[model samples]
Target: MDIPYTSKPRPDTGLYNAKVGIWLFLASEVMLFGALFSSYILLRVGALEENWPHGLLNIPIGTFNTAVLIISSVTVVMAWASLKMKQFGRFKIFQAITVLCALAFLGIKSFEYKDKFTHYEVWKTDGTRMTGHIEGNPMFLTKAKLVAAGKDKIEFLADPHHYSEGKLKIGAQSGEHKHVEIAIGDIKRLSAFVPAHSTYFAIYFTLTALHALHVLGGAIVIGFLFGPGSKMWHTDPDRFTNRVEVAGLFWHFVDLVWIFLFPVLYLL
Candidate 1:
């Protein structure tokens, strides 16, 4: 038997089966992200004042990714509207742009993650801490590695202000960095910005990685509709349009989560 309410609304809810189903699915998504966000706030509040790192993320890159997701949001809406107007060609163009934006966002995020893994923070026996890129751009390098290599000193390009400076600033990264040499004997500890570095980074990676997965999942579903799944549009146009609307709803939720994520993780 054919599925009821595939294209038609149910009397009680006045929404098609897929639309009702997507709304329920989105409700669960909200709860999942909500718990993680709450964990972030609790961790931040309980941490020592000077221990939390700030102004470490690349705000400029974060801002650019925000714009990319916003653009995809607009394009997805236009794609659904194009289907409503029976303009299949326009729908194809708009949906293609949405998928491209999703890819651009993911590419930039991967670049940011690579940068973090290569970056390092060092605490010297002299009671000082500094963060920046170690010379040669090694990933997850440690004091033991330097000693094992029999290296006497490490050349580092260091940020002038300590991460706790609360620079409360953006785009001021132009001229405030310098190069320095650190002796292995004086090194107390060394770590990259991975979750083990601190509670702040733990939440940072957990939240962003989860959000990235959602973006990938939404892109895959929408991309399918843009390709082989478009065949449904020819055989059953109304059902296909309803499918696009449901996908669009989920895409909007993905975009909204990033909006909240940008400021919380990057700014304050």
Candidate 2:
């Protein structure tokens, strides 16, 4: 039997089957992200003010990713609009641009993740926490070494913000940051600012990684619609157009999620 409303809208709903399906799927997605946002808020509010880390994430990089996503959202709409105008070549061009933006966003995100993994945080015996890029593997001053000499410190550049004095205020802040030698015995523990490092990092990794997966999924669907799926444009033009609309809707949702994510994770 032929399925109805693949392209044609149902009389009562005024929407094709594919469009309805997409909306239902999008509703569930809304709930999924809503829960994550709620969790983030609760976590942020409950945490101690001084204990929570801020300004650790790179804002410039986050801003760049936001721009990429915003542009892709526009291009995806244009691609779908091109189909409505029966401009096949224009649709292909816009769709390709959308996919390229996705790649760029993912590339920038990967770089951000790499920086977090390489950055280190050290806690001293006196309860002072120092965070920065490591100079070398933190030396483990064994009990024997600690007793042999009072040299018990891990060497690392103090995180730029840790010392708010005149020194950090005026500086190039590239490969050259304030370096300090901490005795190993004085060091309680040290590790990179990874997911396991703290609650903030754990949640940061979880939320961003999930969003990245969504971007990848959306890119694959868009790429397919731009290439192999375009064949349907010839054989069944209406059905193909409906598919494009549905995919565009999903893409917009993905972009919206990032808009929320950038501020909560990066800016605030």
Candidate 3:
């Protein structure tokens, strides 16, 4: 048998089944994100002042992504409006722009992830620390290679941009480029700016990755509605328009999450 309330409102609720369902789903989404956001606040506030990382993420890149999502939200409205007006061609154009915006956002996110993976921090037993991007693959230290170096340290070059001359101890990137060494016995810790490196990074990757997955999911649904799902417009215009409206609601929620995320994670 065909399902009831697929397009029509129910007598008791005076709302379509899908409409009620979407609202319930979004309520659950709010709670999920709310818990994570609360965790972020607790982590940030409780972090040791001196150890908290700052000015690490690229603000300009993040601001651009924020703008992209904001614009896509506008397009989503335009697409829905076009369908309501029975202007199929305009709806198609607007929806296509929405998909392109989603792709652009994902592309930028990947670049940011790549930068973090390449960045490194090293700690030595002598209480010295270094920060820079690894220039090449970190070579395995054979006993022969160690003997040839005539030193007790593993040798590797830091990315010249963050390399500094003469000075030791943890500091911001600056000064002349040079090869550096950390003795295995003297090595306290060595790692990239990955999740395991610190509490900051651990939450950073987890939260942002989860949000990105939401973006990906929204894009896939919007994509289907834009392409194969458009066929419904020909057979049942009202139902098809309702579908777009439902999808648009989800898209707007995705955009709103990023609006909160950009400032909270990227700024304060």
Candidate 4:
């Protein structure tokens, strides 16, 4: 006679747990980024005594990148829909498009970084070393000239009278005596300085770099699903579809982070 055997029930991932887990993870990420951004706000605001670095950021390039990420998010949804409908061919097409969009986002980001480097706007934490004088942009000279020619707003905002005292102090200390000539057009070129080896620059670099890493990770996952080693999952469309859904969740998270970051870094 043989004894009957019973198998134990597997643990269930309840609907609440699935949703809560994602939210909890996002909350933690928010806290992490919140700390970084708060530090940035404190340091920059304190240093400038009220001014912030919004003018230094390239709004147009950032806006274009924002659009790219938004479009990529849409393509990701399309890819998921294709998988759900069991249209593997169309799913692949959408997946590829999403990857391309991610690549384009990185390309645009590269250009922005290049612009920063070229302008010598990059900073270090140390006080002794810094690149890029605030006067490099000719637009500021033009604005100064305009202000001198009786531009009321310019005279009000960056009045040579006010800046002269501060400029002389800086010049005397640094032994860099430069005359205060308020060129009418130079006001446009005026940008807040990034201190050498400053924590603000570190935070900026780290946050953006981490976001880019997420995009790279998403691209790798997508590639693996369609690459040679995908045979195991390919044979089982249901399982493969679930995998795509999970990947889509991660991609959406990356996009969501950028949504918040765009306003904090570029807009604010």
The C-alpha RMSD in Å for every predicted model, in order, reads 1.6, 4.6, 5.0, 12.0
lDDT of 4 by residue, 217-268 (tens): 8888876766653464556665566566666777888898889888777755
Flag regions of model 1 displaced more than 4 Å.
148-150, 169-171, 174-176
lDDT of 2 by residue, 1-268 (tens): 9999898999999999988898999999999999988998999899876666666777788999999999999999999899999999999999999999999999999988888777877778898876676565433323344456765454577755542232323233544467898767677776677777777888899899999999999999999999998999999988998898999999999999999999998766
**Tens digits of per-residue lDDT for model 1 on 48-128?**
877998888998899999999999999999999999999999999999999999999999999999999998899999999
Q: Which ten residues in a row have the lowest lDDT in candidate 1?
A: 166-175
Query: How does each model score on lDDT?
Result: 0.92, 0.82, 0.80, 0.60
lDDT of 3 by residue, 186-265 (tens): 76676777887778888889889988998899899899999999999999898898888899999898899999988887
Per-candidate TM-scores read 0.94, 0.87, 0.85, 0.63
Instruction: Give the TM-score (vs. native) of candidate 1.
Output: 0.94
The runs of at least 3 residues in candidate 4 whose Cα sits more than 4 Å from the true structure, single-residue gaps closed, are: 1-11, 15-28, 44-51, 121-199
Alpha carbon lDDT of residue 50, candidate 1?
79
Over all chains combined, what TM-score does candidate 3 have?
A: 0.85
Give the count of colliding residue pairs in each prediction: 0, 7, 0, 26
Winner of 1 and 3 under TM-score: 1
